[model samples]
Target chain A: MRLSTKFSDTIHLLAFLQVYSDIKLTSAVIAASIQTSPVVVRRLVGALKNAGFIDNDPKNHNPRIAIDPKDITLLDIYLITEGHTPLFVIDKETNPLCRVGGNIQPVLTNIYGEAEQAALTVLNSKTMQDIIDSLIVHNKVKQAKEKSDLAQDA
Target chain B: MRLSTKFSDTIHLLAFLQVYSDIKLTSAVIAASIQTSPVVVRRLVGALKNAGFIDNDPKNHNPRIAIDPKDITLLDIYLITEGHTPLFVIDKETNPLCRVGGNIQPVLTNIYGEAEQAALTVLNSKTMQDIIDSLIVHNKVKQAKEKSDLAQDA
Candidate 1:
């Protein structure tokens, strides 16, 4: 029903780093925010490091975003997390006698690839700066609403 | 690692019906081409029927496209098969103490939705007729290559 949350989690990790730039965080701390275990955080952190997006030290859990938040797109995160996997998977084994079965793979491959590319293109347009800004804006609005609600209660 | 293959299989099923309109096929036969079981075939067939893309009867294994192939887009088929499932999933549970964790969902909901819409837009541009055409063309090329190879052997 759902795809992996790694892409979103990766974004969350990076966004947290940007928002709390002054704070040093261990996998345990990041994992709490992601609602996952420290192990998962380390794995994702390792992946981001390999992709040259972040720098980490063994002695310190603190991570620095090597690339600007505005510079990183969801597509970049996706490429690191999902790794060019097909959006649609075809059934490989087919009755060879069926002419359509024998030749449908390549056709679907092209079509599905285009659709996946379209999704990636949309992701490419979004930067981590957009995410961090939206988070800040939404929280401000939420806080304002809560203050208003509390005044009405009083 | 991969999302559901239902979308691709749905396309495959419809393509088979279009290519072999003259042949009446039971689930067993369709399953053979799909390399899946008859039960899986029936389930998919039911989905297609419910989506108003196909008409089938218990007495007759013959199913008709019910709509023009060109008129049916991949988005239509996707809506039927996959039903607007989020392409990216966000982790819901987050540490309340972490400001980023407390408010990341809405931001992601917006971002993920846009990316999914992008994919659907591309799929909407494509039709079953396009798939059928590609299948026909690829088969011709493949057959031609086989013949040329045989001639060289002779």
Candidate 2:
């Protein structure tokens, strides 16, 4: 009954990857950064890997997944994780007797397909780097405030 | 953890309502068409009603919710059934002791907010009528096939 939280999780992971693009981050680091378990990160990474949205260095013997932040889009992650399912879901068992129910699937599928495409269209507009840039700006603002606090103390 | 199939269900329901806009439908009828339990229809109707997406006849006292297809949008139905959760999901718990985890919440929240906004932008682009139009077209195609089949039989 819940909308999958993976879509949100993927965004969080992407933000971290974008912020730490230069560093080889371990799953533990991502897990820590996101306040989640490393096992969870591994699961998400598997999906992202299958979708070719991320690269994992098992050879480095590290659990870190290297992300090409520039190459990653929110849609890239969403499709790998949450996007495969039709944007709208219908029950496998619909009333067979109702003409509408009998015919609704194909009809609904077409409609949902369009709506989902619309959803993806919006998702495609934002990139991992855009999120990272906002974070950097936030950090700068925080640093500026901290400097002001120190000056007041002096 | 999965996106509830309810939005799809609601849309299907509404599309049928759009087609049968003049009819007073019962939950049993809707459940029959949707091939789900009547209770499920009632539940969805209760939500749709609360969201002001539809009106059930107070006079009929039947187990039906009257829907106003013109006033409803796919986005309205989606948010109603899905609640105001983010389009993406994050873990409920991350290691609180990790500095990254500690900071990740606000950062991720901000990003998730933006990502959700992006998703909403797409979802908001279309209305219920638009979906119905697509459905009607699909039905016409289906009817044409049925007619062609009848002709072949003759």
Candidate 3:
């Protein structure tokens, strides 16, 4: 199965909200930026909006991230999107009479928990500002490269 | 939609092989422990065996883990199972005219790489022996609890 892009889409929505806060936000506009349908964008915005991460109604009204960009971590978005689900799944149909089968689930559960926590810690370490800052840096680099190509063409 | 348990099942298969080494290994026997079909067990065994992590032909021959348990990390299993696929997905169809959409994919890609590496680090920290050890510990705890409960009932 393809990995769901819901988490990344939501992050993009938030970053879009922050980067273009001057424009009156609509699902269509954000969807255009995401290159997905407005329906998908509205749904994502609705999730973040209901979770209080973003402010504004989802009926194509003005939308913006409600929280400080610095305060919103990837974990903050992830918790609402994907982090609540277990990363690793254990086989539940194992024979309880067998020692290995009987005890494997809990052992796996503990290790999966630790691994997910480590991943979440990394997600929590970065703020929305970090994402936006990185975005700006990449944008600038691309622009500079474009300018050099244009100068060479001239 | 659902996360695959292929990795966990492989781990269980290997642990069972190592623990029950005296017993002849068969896919049906492994399936019985995993509470799944022999076909499923064979598929898992085939993967591990082909990867050089386990020994023996997967046609119900004497199958056993080939590597040292302590040397085989969870990452080793995950790499063949889920780790090779990205844990996160980016919206690649984003509009390049917009700064957020234009540069979001690469920025998110970098961040996702970091988060996955952190999770992988935790998975790599634990060897197959660690999983088996935890299983044994959990088994002892359960056995003790069961005995205490039987005495109370008696």
Candidate 4:
């Protein structure tokens, strides 16, 4: 099954907001940071705003994270961005004449629902702060390695 | 986050195989039953066959379920179809200059991995038999409702 990068992109957006909470972020600035277009950033920003994840004023056009990063989980971001859609979509035009085709949608829907709930349970265990903390550690490690490489070169 | 229908289609294909195990099923027949093209059916069938979920004879081109339906979990099917890929894909070209963009991939990857494992836990609790039983029940209910409606019309 092909998975989209929207989920990752959303997280990146949120982490950026959290890390740079002091700065007023614009769509163009976010677009440049995420290596995406301003239109894409605006669309996601709109969704996040609508979902109460972020607050944006039309007059100001600057977006800020509304909820506490520690209070938000990846599951929350997923639900906000993707809505309540199942992880896998069933074909709407499956052949009804065939027994499996006729009955599989509901059965699979139930199964997918359970799987999603399970995934949410895991995601809920982690807060956005957890993600930010890891990112900080990762950046520090990379910086340390870069410094070591420069010292060797000298 | 658009989802692919491959997972549901795969389950439909497998359920059909179990229900009609006595019959020699061809890709065309399966495609017709699943309301998909022969090429699509062949692709999924090939994947399943390679993953040891089904067996196919090259000369005859007849496919049969290689594993007991009761032994095949949705998690197994998910793993086979998706391999070790996370449910969410991380963008490799995210802006490296941005602190969050540079480090978010690994953090999100770790979170996604945990979420997938949790989802697998739920999927593992269910077997092909569970799906088949649900399908059988669904079919019977639909048939009964149809019969009742017909009797009322008469």
Index of the highest-lDDT prediction: 3
Per-residue CA lDDT of model 1 for A1-154, tens digit only, reads 3567888799999999888767678788788888899999999989999889998644555787889888999889988998756667777777666778888888888887887888889899999999999989988888898899999999
Worst 10 residues of 4 chain A by lDDT: A56-65
lDDT of 1 at B98: 70
RMSD of 2: 4.3
Evaluate residue B26 in candidate 2 and report its C-alpha lDDT on the 0 to 100 scale. Answer: 76
For model 2, residues A16-113, the per-residue Cα lDDT tens digits are 66556456677777877666688888788777767666665455543333555666677777777775665456666775445556566776565556
lDDT of 3 by residue, A1-154 (tens): 5657888888888988888877778778888888899999888877887899888746545787788899999999988988656766777878898989999998998898898888888999999999999999999999999999999999
Q: Top model by DockQ, which number?
A: 3
Q: State which candidate, 2 or 3, has the greater DockQ.
A: 3
Candidate 1 vs candidate 4: the TM-score winner is 1
Residue-level lDDT for B36 in candidate 4: 85
Off by over 4 Å in 4: A1-3, A56-62, B56-62
lDDT of 2 by residue, B1-154 (tens): 4566687788778776656645667777777777778899889878876767667546654323354445556667778877565555566665454333334556657655665565556556667777677666766777899899999999
**After superposition, which runs of candidate 1 have C-alpha atoms over 4 Å from their true positions?**
A57-61, B57-61
Worst 10 residues of 4 chain B by lDDT: B56-65
**Ranked by DockQ, top first:** 3, 1, 4, 2
Query: Each candidate: how many clashes?
Result: 0, 15, 0, 0
DockQ of each: 0.71, 0.43, 0.73, 0.66
The residue-level lDDT of candidate 1 at A58 comes to 48
* TM-score for each of the candidates: 0.93, 0.73, 0.93, 0.86
